[model samples]
Target: MTQKDAPTGADATIPGKLPATGHQGRQEPAAMTSTPTTTRTSTRAPLAAHGTGRVPPRSGAVLAGLCAAVLALSGCGGQKGGSPAAGSVPDGWGTLATSGVSVSYPKAGSGSGGYTVQTAGERSKYNAAAAERTEHGVTVSLITIQLGFTRADTAEDAAIAAEAGIQLGSTIRSTRKVKLAGTGDARRIDFEFGSTGEDRTPPKGTRIEGVILTGLDSKDRTFAVRVDARKGTLPDADLKRIVDSIEVH
Candidate 1:
């Protein structure tokens, strides 16, 4: 669907189902690096496959480490004079429930909607923590979040709320239709921009976008839903890598 086809306003209804043919399963190398702490536990590990299902490590450690790194970087820069007070530290990534739908937060980062809105500088500092790579002619840095819902709840409400900062028009335009692991289900959702043109240092091509997915468990409880976004438009190939990288079981 085109941008004009979408409803106007920031609070628009997200379209129901996306076309199934637009996305492809992509295989890419997963590279993990971890720094030693005072303890013996290593922080990073490739999520393991359990009985044909993808189950990632608890998102708590990864998110806490990333937040700590950002706070440290912000302190080092000492640029708080004009910058807004850093917003609430996000909750640890885990299962979140609201109404009927439930979702598991994907690994790689915290919950999608709870990000600390950073100034251009702050956003830049966080982006720098991840290894940089270019895909789809649009520069992209890999990112992830977990989405979850509780028993007896549907994930629809949470999914809608997560679209808050997203610009519906631009989002529809950039979403690449995709399917994961031969599941007949397809996914699509727009990216979100944290700052406008001049405020952003990345070239004009960079548009913050969100990737969304939905599913239901055996009991009919909606399960781990997800939306991922980064600073710019990502090549479909790169976008698939980020989406496929997510693990939930």
Candidate 2:
């Protein structure tokens, strides 16, 4: 794909080192992280309150102080475990919502190949989900949609941070800010990535492409919609349609 904006990785840079990237949104690549340290120590440090310069409340703020150890795959939140995405996905076109955030896509065998799904969990900002369409052993869809929560201060940072998953050795192409339906302060990052072909899927040295769209919902928590596929899988029209279907309630 041609570079529409300009080469920049400012989007993947987390604020003072939060999570790096679930599939990178790069779990926040199912794990790839850098520079973000989330420890499960006491609340005295208040990692969340560091940037705000505001004193943490005396009580009931314990949840606010701890950093979500999402990318690391370390259970470090309110201690809640995870669950499979709720609701049986339809075989045709369908829509699924988690923690009030939603995205629409063609379900597995619905068209455009076979798609599988993952949903949100009970924990806020900890749940992550994705919709994938694959055929045989190779990825057929141009955009595999992934949705997850972030604790960033704004959508600007979160969107920039969702770079990708299993995208070995990804390089930045361009990044630009744009508006999307039902989302606030959205940003888009386009990049080129590589595949190690470890599972003999794409073969060695296969070229992979990815995009990350981070935006804000009503509660100020950030959400990520990331897509990746073999280069030139489809046009931008279908991608736009899938992205426009996203809604954070």
Model 1: per-residue lDDT, tens digit, 21-112? 01112222233221122111222211110001122222445445432321100110011122322111123533322232322232334323
lDDT of 2 by residue, 1-249 (tens): 111111122111111111222121221223233324222222222111001111122222433332232122211111012222222223355665656456666666555553455322211122244454555655433222223333456554454335322122446554445444454345555555444343222554666555555556566665655555555653455555455565555
lDDT of each: 0.26, 0.39
Model 1: lDDT of residue 64: 52
Candidate of highest lDDT: 2
Q: How big is the positional error of residue 198 in model 1, measured in Å on the Cα after superposition?
A: 8.4
Candidate 2, which segments miss by more than 4 Å at Cα?
1-92, 118-127, 140-150, 163-168
How displaced is residue 244 in candidate 2, in Å? 1.4
